[model samples]
Target: METTHGAEHVHVGRDGWLFLTAGSNNVVGQFSRSRLMARRVRGWRRLVVARVRGCERLGCRYLHVIVPEKLTVYDHKLSAGLRVKVRLSPALRLRRALFWHRSARRACLDLVGAFRAVRDARDLYFRTDSHWSFAGCDTAYRLICAACGAVPKDLSGEPQEWRQMAGDLGSKLTPPQSERWPIRGLQRDAVRVHASPIVELRERTGRADKLHVGAHVIYRNDAAGTDPRRVVLFGDSYAHFAPIMLTALIAETFAEVHFVWSSSLDWGYVERVRPDLVIGQVAERFMFELPDDRFDLKAYAAERFGTELAEAEAKSARKPGKNSDKSPGKKPGKAGTSVAGP
Candidate 1:
C-alpha cells in the first residue's frame, strides 16, 4: 500500500489555503498579517455549531483539543465516519471547481501536448489505469522520436492488432496496492510481442551443461524492400509499454525492435545487444537506492570515472595541504604543506 507521509491536504495557490471546515464548508481567504486567515462569517457560525453538536453526539473526547498529537481508537473510528459523511457531497463539487481552476486546466493542456507528441492516442497509456497507459506509451514513443529528431514513418500497412496476451513484465511487477485498490478485475489492454530469437528458459535432466538458446530471423518475401532502423531497448517493465507502442505505430520506421525488462538481465546484456539508444527505466522513488551487486550502476560509474575525479581531488588536496603545513618561518600563503583541506 502507498504509505502516508502526513495528514492529507490540497494546495490551492498563493492567495490562500482552502481548509475543510467543521460542516464541510470550504474556508478560503487571503493570508492576513494577523494569525487567523479569516474570522467566521454569520452563516458559518451556525454550521460550526452543528458540527460541534455532531461531534458531541459521536462522543468526540478530543474535539476541544485542536490537532491531537496522536489519534486514539475512538478518535480514529469517529474521524473516519465523520470524514466519509463530510466529504461525500463536497468532493464532487470541489472536483468541478478544480476543473475550472486555471493551473489545473493548464496542466491538462500540457498533457494534451504530450499526447499529440505521440500522435497515436491508442498507444498513450494502459487500458485500465493512468500509470503509463497504452496510450501513454504511444505518446512517449512520439516524444522519443521527436527528441532524436527522427522522421517517423506511418505504419498503417504494418501488422498491428489488439490481442489479449497475458500480463507483461509491467503488470507482473505491479505493487500489491494496485491489486488491492478499490477498482479490481478491470480489463487491461495487452499486446502480443513478436521478436526474433525469442529466448525461453527451462529445466533439464542429465548433464544440463548446454544453455538451450535459439535464434531466428524472418525476411519479408515482398518485392518492395522496406528499410527501417533496427532498435533494441534494455530496461525495466516501464520500457515494455513504450517499445510496444512505438513498434505498433512506426513498425516500418524500424526494421526490427527488441525490448527486454531488467528482471532477467545480466550486466553485459546491454553491451551484448548493442542498440542505437539505451533507455534505463528506473522508478524515481527508488533511483538512489543501490541495486543488486551485479547491477550496481553507481559502483560501475565510479569505477569508470572515479579515477579522474579522485585525481582532481588529490591535486586540490595537495595545494591546501602545502599551505597549511607551512613552518613558523613561512608566510600566511605557505600555511599548508602537511595540512589538507577538510
Candidate 2:
C-alpha cells in the first residue's frame, strides 16, 4: 500500500509504515546537508572513536550501534512511483567510512547490514513509529550481543502480545485532536518491561553548545543477573528500544544497567560508576552532529572528580595566600613546596 501526503517529510509506505522523506531534515541527522560525504563522515567517525577510547581506558568493552534510516531497510515496500526517486545518502550506507575503516571497525556494529540480512514478513521498522518495531529491536539487540561476544537468548519462550498504534510520522499528517494515525502491532513482546522513572540531568554546567548541553536519562535495572559487570548505555531515543529486551535478559544477567540518554560525549558518568561494559549508540543520520558533542576528557575528569581527587585545589582556590601543600602543622621546605623533613 502506497500513499502520498502534501507533507513530503511524512510519506506513507507499504502496510502503513510511515517514513521520513529526504527533506524531513527532522529525522535525526543533519547529514543530508553533507550528503554523507566520505571525507566529512570520516571526520565524524573519528569523533565517535575519541568517546569510545575513553571507555577503553576504564577496561570497559565498547559497542557502537548506528541505526539506519527506515527506508533503507524496507524501501522495497515503498510505493511504486516514489521508490525510484528516493536514495540513501552515502554516509547512511557507511561502507566507505566506518564499515571499511580499520580504525573504527572493531567498535562499529553494522546495524544497516544486520537489518538487511533478516527477512521478516513484518517490516523491520514500525509502520506507525519512528523507531524500529519489536522485531527490528530484537535484531539490533542480538547483533549487539553477538558483537560483544555474548550469547543471544532464546526469546521463543517469552510471552507475546499485539496492539493498535499510530506512528510518529503518521501522527504528523493527522488533524489536531483527530484520532491520530492508527497502526497495528501484530507481534509484540509479552514479557513486562517496566522501567523505573528516568533520572534526568544536565551535564557539565554551562556548556556552550546547545546540542551538546541537554537533558539526559539514567535507567537503573534492579533485576539480578550473574554477569558482574555494570553496564552503561548512551544514546538518544534510539537507545530506548534497543535495550528493553537486553534489560529483561539483563534484569537477571548483569549486576545492574545504567542508561545515559544524550548526544553529548562525556566520560564523567563512566568515571563515577566505573561500569564494566560501555555501549554508545546513535542513528546514522545524526553521525554528522557528533563533532559538536566533543569535549576534553581530561578536563571533565578533573572537574567531575574534584572533591574526590584532592582537597588542595579547592582549598587553594578559596584562600589566595595559603600553602595548600602543607599539612596542618607541616612546614613548606623548598620555595613553598612541602617536603619531608631532611
Q: Per-residue lDDT for 1-342 in model 1, tens only?
A: 122232122211111111222212122111112223112222222322333343334332101101100010011222222322222222122223335343322211122334433433243323222234444544455555554445644323323444442222213222311211121111112122332212211111222223211111111111134333444333443443232333343333444444443322233433443434333233211221223414433344356445744564455457744553332121221222111100
Using TM-score, give the best candidate's number.
2
Separately for all candidates shown, the number of backbone clashes (residues 3 or more apart, or on different chains) is 24, 7
TM-score of 1: 0.31
Give per-residue CA lDDT, model 2, range 59-163, as digits (tens): 887777777777667667677555521244433544445665564676777777778778356456667666765577667778877776665555534334444
Q: Which ten contiguous residues of candidate 1 have the minimum total lDDT? A: 64-73
For model 1, the local distance difference test gives 0.29
Cα RMSD for candidates in order: 24.1, 12.2
Best by lDDT: 2
Error of 2 at 169 (Å): 1.5
TM-score of each: 0.31, 0.64
